[model samples]
Target: MPKGKRTRIVALTRTRKKGLDSKKKLMDDLRSCLEDYERVFVFSVRDMRNAKLKDMRTKWRTSRFFFGKNKVMAIALGRTAEEEQADGLHKLSKALRGQCGLMFTNSAKDDVVDFFGKYVEADYARAGAVATDDVALEEGPLPDFPHSVEPYLRLKLGLKTTLNRGVVTLLKPHIVCRKGERMTPEQTRLLKLMNHPMAEFRVNLVAVWSKDGVVERLNPDADGEEDEEEEGSGAEDDAEDMDSD
Candidate 1:
């Protein structure tokens, strides 16, 4: 080792150790969320853009939404879910098969369900998103784009572009994407450029748990109708998926 500038051992964080710590913290926080609310709603999230999620979180002042690794959520609610946390909450934890999150609200379950039913906002589709329908654009002057972007749009993005009156214009009409097609990076970019957002963002409330431990699933077979549950004790939810990551 040099006396003037000696090298010291740099501590490296082990992946397993760091991951375990993070998982533990997430479990603790989620358990706390479960304990705070009279009811917990399990819901699915898709195309969850962080900015929009943040805005929605801000708007819903009375409700708290916690999204995390599904495994962590399941573990936190309980290993068996029934014995560790309040009643029926384990059902929600058990159903954590995909991307999922829990919503803790003091509001009435019916009101929450109705709010979710009517709440839908359009957002840009990202790569890996499935196309719901064909998106076609007609040839026109796209004055929204500046003339400076014409070269990049034409050369890089495979779009026919020309400058007219200090604005960019599309030279031809073409189908941007087709139904059932998996969105590509280029397609996502082009949609954004065309200001055509393709994804519908909304919360699908799958299950709800009461403070007294009643659990009910929002039965989709009945046209998103609520299913009746035997009233009991325990505050638990086991439904839907919310993958925060």
Candidate 2:
């Protein structure tokens, strides 16, 4: 039998934050693990989806990921987690300039890199995320919606809707939003109501430190601030390619 809304999966709304002792423990743990691991990869995080990250962490169970304050993580690796990581990990921590994390693993670099490149998934667009595509609500019956939501959608979004046979129907097709624009709150609500996906989250590996004392920038030309389709200066690329072994 089919389940009701009570049995539906729900995402976590709030994440547990670290306290003073927890932060120190993380640094201590990372510092000690630095010696035990052979290869280290620095990854940046943006619009982090904690649940998605937790799932990815589980997938890479063979490796270790440390996400925290860059300075603390840097200090754990050596004298400078911001300027330099370790002797072999020089400039590795510099990639930690923004929201960053450290990945320690004994895994092959090629395999790890390939996995990250192929692992992009659509995420719910949050405030400030650039729209990846045009999202609209067509003139038609909203089958899945309950009849009660008609008023809120009409009043809040300026949507032309009417209740017909206990279902919300749009009077005319309208552009809820356009591409290449910052997501607005009303548009966000409309997207949720219409079940439209407008954002893509992917990891962009900017730099890597291999086991054989080699260091390299994996995506030197990757613009962090620009989407894959857009062209912009690299200086503002404060985006990410987060996590894993």
Candidate 3:
């Protein structure tokens, strides 16, 4: 066969892919924000909730928030003095080690601080979340719950319940959860069914970087916060998707 007319087959080989284009774009955007915004803040989220985050995004449409992808964000801010995008950015990057994010804004510092400090949303606790308070059901008629749910409360949830006069009644005092204890899936579900919200989703400012090369540590005690990656919890997977905007 003539070389010009020969058919070619490509061989597939395993090669480690490096430097994701998405990550590069993020780095570029972060660097751009460093120049464009008047201030950058590192904030940590406790009990992350996507709906609340989306609400905040809408409320602060002019500002930018980046969540998840901690390593990429840290690199974008510059991990060291020699490679930092700007003065004091390296210190800000250090705060990115935990379940935290970066906020870039031109808003006044006091306004931003006041808003986040007061912003707290209570949500139903998910499995693996620690209970904030003790939840118990009295040994009596549960008039709030319908009789149809008696079987589910008894068999599925393992709750001691009975249908008495078309009402769900707890045969004995039941403890749903205890304070400072990690809740199980059943416990969380029962709490939700009872219309109890134990998880408090709040964002706390850890550090801040200003355009004037000034870095302020608002939460120095948060240095030891654990990174979510280490736990492999995948708790913020939904939050990561929301970052697409």
Candidate 4:
């Protein structure tokens, strides 16, 4: 081999090693986040138009979403492609390949999943879909509904479903995520306290707690009112006069 070619090969090897080291460091960081945080939200977004991007910048006044390379992320996650497929983290890997991003937080895992599911449904609904399957959903952000349901429903709904204020209504309020739009200051501030330990959810009047508490809703048939009459204190004539008036 030529000396020049040999030198170039050696340089490339060193660069590759450095890259691997950096990726390992990133993986460790993510793993640490996993330990510290209770949940993570993954997003898939198409490339924004220039005008839309500028509008998002002004509207959100927040950091732009980051699109990390899939290969680097695989390394950062310390998972081989085969292993990811085996373990089911591969979907996250696949999403990273497209126009995608992720949001990480230490909030409740159920809350995070709920948030992502609602976020996607909100966007899909904005495109004009009539109803979302969120009512029946339980665990994962991704669901396996009947094949006839999903993209078909979304396509029928179409684009222009967005509200004037840009808040996509979900089945629940806590799970809302407004893309390319600024959340009101109130919303941002409220999110911080939303994942609180004592926080509860009520369907009708029953309260459901985050940790492990439950309150049952009142059943009308279960509770009957007393029909017993009290002894009258006022004169019947006076009562008749009052009613007459």
Please state the error at residue 107 of candidate 2 in Å: 0.8
Residue pairs with backbone atoms closer than 3 Å in model 3 (clashes): none
Candidate 4 collision pairs: 27-76, 127-158, 128-157, 129-157
1 or 4, greater by lDDT: 1
Tens digits of per-residue lDDT for model 2, 1-245: 77776886657896655466755776677767667787888775455666666677777887887666665665566554344445656567556555556778888889889999888777678766677778777799988778888999899888899998898999999887778888788888778777776766666677887656677888764424433233211211111222322
Local accuracy of candidate 4 as per-residue lDDT tens digits, 162-234: 2223333223223323344444333333232222111121111111112121212222132112221311212
Per lDDT, the best of the predicted structures is 3
**Which prediction has more favorable TM-score, 2 or 4?**
2
- Off by more than 4 A, model 4: 1-18, 47-66, 78-91, 108-245
Candidate 4 — worst ten consecutive residues by lDDT sum?
200-209
Off by over 4 Å in 3: 1-19, 227-240, 243-245
lDDT of 1 by residue, 1-245 (tens): 55656656666863332357666766777778776778988776556655656666766677777666565677788757545577777776655545556778889988888887888889999998888889876798877777887898888878887888777888898678999999888888888987888898877877877878787887433222222231110112211112232
User: How many clashes would you count in candidate 3?
Assistant: 0
* Model 3, residue 97: C-alpha shift (Å): 1.7
lDDT of 1 at 139: 95
Report the Cα lDDT for residue 186, model 1: 82
Rank by lDDT, highest first. Answer: 3, 1, 2, 4
Query: What does the lDDT come to for candidate 3?
Result: 0.81
Q: Please report how far candidate 2 places residue 15 from its true position, in Å.
A: 13
Predicted candidate 3 versus true structure: per-residue lDDT over 1-245, tens digit per residue? 56765677666775544347756777787888787899999887877777888888888988888774777788888899998988888888777766777889999998999999999988999999988888899999999898888999999999999888898999999999999999899999999899999888888888889998889989766543675565213423533454556
TM-scores for all candidates?
0.75, 0.75, 0.83, 0.28
